[model samples]
Every structure is written in structure tokens, then in C-alpha cells.
Target: MYRFLLTRQWLITLLIALLLIPTTIKLGFWQLHRHEARVARNELIAKALTATPEPFDSLSPAPGTAVPADLTWRAVTATGQYDPAHEFVVRKRTDANGTIGYFVVTPLKLSDGKGTLLVNRGWVASGDGAADYPPVPAAPAGEVTLTGRMRADETAKGSGGFIKDRAGLPDRQFNLINTEQQTKETGAPLLGGYLELTATTPAPADQPALIPEPNHSDIGPHMAYAIQWWLFTAMIPVGVWVLVRREAKDRAKQQAEPEVTPEAVPA
Candidate 1:
């Protein structure tokens, strides 16, 4: 059976099977690693959300500087004035009640004499008509204290993108990322990134409130997928063994049969 498996035709098949086993195992391991990474990421996000927001000034002197991992989800308080003229709407946000809406992000000019930081104020529902934006209450002007979590600025998008410009506010439609472009439009020296405000406290009656739930991505499914790949790897050798044994049994049965001359044979 071993020699038969080594024959040119069978050997090719065996080589393929052997090669596939390791490859499958490697793929399984890769998935397992990804599963662990997702778990870690989820944990980090959870930890950050629960902790108090740290001071925005404590992060760094420049835009691209890395903030320590532990500081990511902490609650931060900043005193600033909201610049509604520089505000932009971010597309595709949903609320805790599963209502579809857009995020209203406006620049908050910090009172510390440092430049402005973009604030993701809250979500607003699309009103009755496509041209209608749900009424957003006027932001408190002149040295307002806002609390939220810090987020990195969004990178500028490449050409052929989904964001398109409009002539006016409240009725405008666009997928705004970081406030860099909006700040440039307003000629304001804005902070590098934006802050996602949590709705821990109530805003003025007419203002849209922040959604505070922590977002989670699933890791369990990936682990199950990895196990499936490993099982396939284990099945390959068993399949080969069964095929070889069946072939051997057939050969043995042929050899054990007695041969008779045509004259001696009964019809």
C-alpha cells in the first residue's frame, strides 16, 4: 500500500494532500491569532470607554503623536465655543433605539488659547423631507464646557468618493470625516482630531443627545472558523488511509479467488 501510494500518479495526490495539511493548519492558526487580536481590541475599547476622559492637552504637542493606549477612552473636559459655521454632517450613524441618523460634528474653539478641536456633538434624525434636517438646538456660545472622548482625525479621502459638497447648512448632505477640511474652510486653527461626546449628561431640550454604548465586533465566529479549518486538516489523512485500505481489500479478494479451466467449470 505504501509503495502504491509512492507510484507517480498516487504520489502526486499524496504530495498534494500532505502539502494541503500543513497549509490548512497554518490557515487555522492564522485565524486563531486574528481571533485573539479581536478579543484584545474589544477589551481595550471597553476599558477606555469606562475610564474617565483625560485632559486633551496631556496627549501631545503635535497631530500625529501617539497617545498612550490607556488614555484612549477616558472622559475629557474642554472649555470651548462651538463654531456652527464650520460644522459638517457625518453619514451612517444609528442610535441605541436603532434609528438611522447623521452625526453633527462642529468645531469647539478651546479656551486654553490652543487651537480648536472638532466635537462630535450628537446624532440627528433625517426629518420628514429629504431637504429637511431635524432641528438642531443652538450650541451654548462663549466659553461652554463640553465633555467627551478624544479620537484621531479622519484622513482625507481619495478621488471618486461618496462625499459631495452642498451650498447650505441643515439641508446639506455629505460624509464628513475629520474636521481638517471644515476648519480650513473656516480659517480656524483646529486641533488634529475630534472628540466623540458621550450622553452621560442631558443637553438643552432641543439639542440631539450623544449615544454612549460601547461598540463591539464579534470574535467568537472567527475561532469557530479556525476550528473548522483544523478539522479539515485532520480529516485528510484519515481519508487517505480509508482509500488505501479499500483498494488493498479489493486486491486481496481477487487473489484469493480460485481459477478453474472452462471444461471443469459448471454452468
Candidate 2:
């Protein structure tokens, strides 16, 4: 009865089942790790958003120094003059409605004149093509104060894979908001991190829609996906067992039937 287990078809099925068991188990754990990371990030965002706003200089006193990772999304205030000449737009940005857009990135010449800070003013709808740059609203003139959340540079290690620097993009268009990269274009020392603009003193008409406050409320469906993967692992074994039981019954029934011999009429 068990001989059939050695057949090519059953052997292949068993091999496949063996491979799937570990694969599903690993996938489940991978999703669980993702779930845990999202939860932690959400907590951090919530904490930062609730804290009191701090002076940008206090957080980053020195130019070219990246902001501490934990301080990301913390509200910060800075005074600066907008240098529109070096301003550019980040490509492939989107709004809350999933509409494709561009992020207006303007260099803010700090009032102290020490260095410039890249400010992501907000998103503006894109034009027909990459070369057709959207008409960005001019930044407020003179020295003005602004409030925004601090964000880390969009380096490969910093953005958590959300953004990365790309080469050969159109002039005045960028894929990532990297301070180091912008420093070369602006011809000025830049603060390590950029700001997600919230409010500006002497607020001009909002042409580029302001970037909304990040939502930390959703934990996402990672946990549900993880559970689903593990459930698939359990089903694999049950399926194999069911197949084996059916095979055994079929073999036993075949044996129970009486063997018939041909009549010796020809003799």
C-alpha cells in the first residue's frame, strides 16, 4: 500500500509540499516584521507631531549636519529669505487624492546668512510633460519666518526606500530631496535636512497646496497578511495528508476485489 508513495507523482508532490512549508513560514515572519516596524514608526510620528515646536537652529546648529533620526517629523521654526533662482521641482510627487504632481522645493537663505535650507513648500499639479514645468507660485519676498516638520535627507539609507536619487532627470527636476545634492545646485552650504512647510508668516496665496500633516493613525494590513501566510502553511500539510488518505483507501479497495482468472476454454 505504501509503495505508491515512492512513485514519481507522489514524490514530486511531497517535494513541493516540503519546499512550500518553509517558504510560507518565512514569508509570514517577514510580514510580521513589517507590521512591527510600521507600528513603531506610527508611534514615533505621533509623539513628534504632538510635541511643541522648536527652533530649527537649536535642532541643527551646524550646517551640513543631518538631523537626528529620532527628531524626524518634529515641528521646527526658521526665518529665511526665499531664493527662487535656485528653486526646483521634485518629480513624481503625489497628493492625498493620488493625483500625480510636483513638489516645489525652494532654497531658503537663512536670515543668519550661514547657509541655505531646502524647504518642500508643497505639491503642485504637473503639466503635460516633464519639460513643461508647472508654474510654481513665487515664495514670499524678504525675510520671513516659517513653521514645518523636520525631515531627514532622502538618502538611500534615510528614506526607508520611499525615495531615492535618480540621475539624468530633466533640468530643475529631481526625484529625491537630498540636501547634499541640492547644495551643489544652490552653490551654498545647506542644512542637512529639509522642512515640510506647514505655515509661513505673511502667508501668500497658497498656489502650491500645502503638504498636509502626516497621518499616524493607520497601522495598515500587514498583520492580516502575515496571518494569511501562516494559515497557508497550515493548509499545505493538511492537503498532503488528505491526498495520502485517499490514495490508501483506493489501494485497499483494489486489493479487496476478487481476482478473476480467464476460463481455460482454449485448452
Candidate 3:
């Protein structure tokens, strides 16, 4: 009575459902890991934001060196004149309110001739997002002190390393905030980390606004999404069982009915 499940079609369907279990379980864990990573990033930002600010000379690494993990997002200051000729911008940034913009970066030539430091001046609107960028207010001439958070050289998006090219990009627009790539272009000694300018000794007006810290108030709905996916997978086998039982019941009911005899056919 239940041999139908042995048929090729039903057997194939069972196999498919069995395969979905592990697939969906893997998807659930994917979301779980995303949530965990975001939480860990928030913790790191918290610790970095609380540390005391220091001078760039103390933290700056020689050109073409990697910024250590412990120094990332560390607060530091530097005094230098802006190398406006080599200024560049990072594309696809969103402000605290989700407004789209770009972050302008200028290489600051240190006063003591030590080396240059890449400074992210701040975000400017990309309303047109065209190559014709709005004129960036010039960085103060002569020696200037800038206090900000130190960040490691950024890699190209989705890629582990930098691919230096200007194709299809606006003049001076970069896909990443890498310092080594800048060193290649300017032939200047640049620190391993770039500065996120938070303050200036004599602040210049009409410059791009400094980017605020990221929002980490919530752990987000990723955990709930993970649970939902797992629950869907768990119900697959139960649904198959219910369908098979229902078919069996219908067959039993048909057999239970007495066979109707046709009245004797009239000649």
C-alpha cells in the first residue's frame, strides 16, 4: 500500500529534499557568521576610539610598509604641508544619514622631511558623480598640525591587493585608500596608515565634513534570519511524510467502499 514511495519520481523527490537540508543549514550559518563578524568589528572600533592621540612621528612607518594590526584606528597627529597635486578621493562613501559622497585624500608632506602621510580630509557630495569634481578647498600652506584616527592602507574592493590603474575612473578617484599605490605615483615616502582627519589646529572652512563613527547600536536581524532558514529546512521532511500519509488514506477509503453492481441490463 505504501510502495509508491519506492517509485523513481518519489525517490528522486526524497533525495532532493534530503539535499536541501544541508544546503539550507549552510545558508543559516552564513548569516550567523555575518552577525558575529559585525559584532567583533564594533568591539574593535570601541577600543580604538577610546585610546589617547599621539604624534605621527611616533606611529608612522617607513614607506611601503604594512601598518600593524594593533595600530589600526589609533589616534595620531601630524604637521605637514599638503601635496595638493597628488590629492585623490575614495568613491562610494555614505555619511551617517546614508547620504552618498566621496572622501578626499591629500598627501601631507611632513615638516621635518620625515615622509608624507595620506590624510582623508573628509566627504564631498557626488551628486553628478562625474569626473569634474568640485574644487576641494586647498589644505593650509606651510606647516599645519592635524589630529585624527590612523587607519591601515585599504585594499581594492573585493580584492586582497591593489591594482593600480586609472581606467574608467574619474581623474584622482581611487577604488581603494591604499598608500603604497600612492607611493608609486608620487615617489614620496608615505606612512603605512592614512589619517582620518578629525581636527586641525587652525581649521579651514568650506572643507568637506569629517565622517562620523559607524552605527553599532544593534546586532541586527541576522540571527532571526538564520533561525528562519533553519526552520524551513526542518519542515521539509515533515511535509513529505504528510503528503504520503494523505495519499494512503485516500486509497484506503476507496477500497472500503462496496463495489456497485450494475442493474441487470434490459434487452
The most accurate candidate by TM-score is: 2
* Cα lDDT listed for each candidate: 0.70, 0.87, 0.81
- What is the overall TM-score of model 3 with all chains considered together? 0.84
Total clashes, candidate 3? 0
Q: Could you tell me the lDDT of residue 253 within candidate 3? A: 93
> Model 2 over residues 1-267: C-alpha lDDT tens digits?
788989999999999999999999999999999999999999999999889998776786355667786899998988989989989998889998989889999988888766678899999998878778788888888988999999987776666787777788888999888887877776687887888999999888655898888889899999999999999999999999999999999999999998876784465
What's the distance in Å from true for residue 41, model 1? 1.5
Give stretches of model 3 more than 4 Å off.
68-70, 126-129, 158-170, 261-267
In candidate 1, what are the lDDT values of residues 197-223, reduced to their tens digit? Answer: 764233455566686656656666889
Clashing pairs in 3: none
- Model number with the top lDDT: 2
Candidate 3: tens digits of C-alpha lDDT, residues 1-267: 988789998899889999999999999999899889878777777777788888876886877777777777778889889988899887777677788778899989888888788999988878454676755677777778998888888765524454343558767887778888888767776878899999987877667878786565678888898999899998989998898899889988998998876675564
Worst 10 residues of 3 by lDDT: 157-166
TM match of model 2 to true structure: 0.89
Better of 1 and 2 by lDDT: 2
3: Cα error in model 1, Å: 3.9
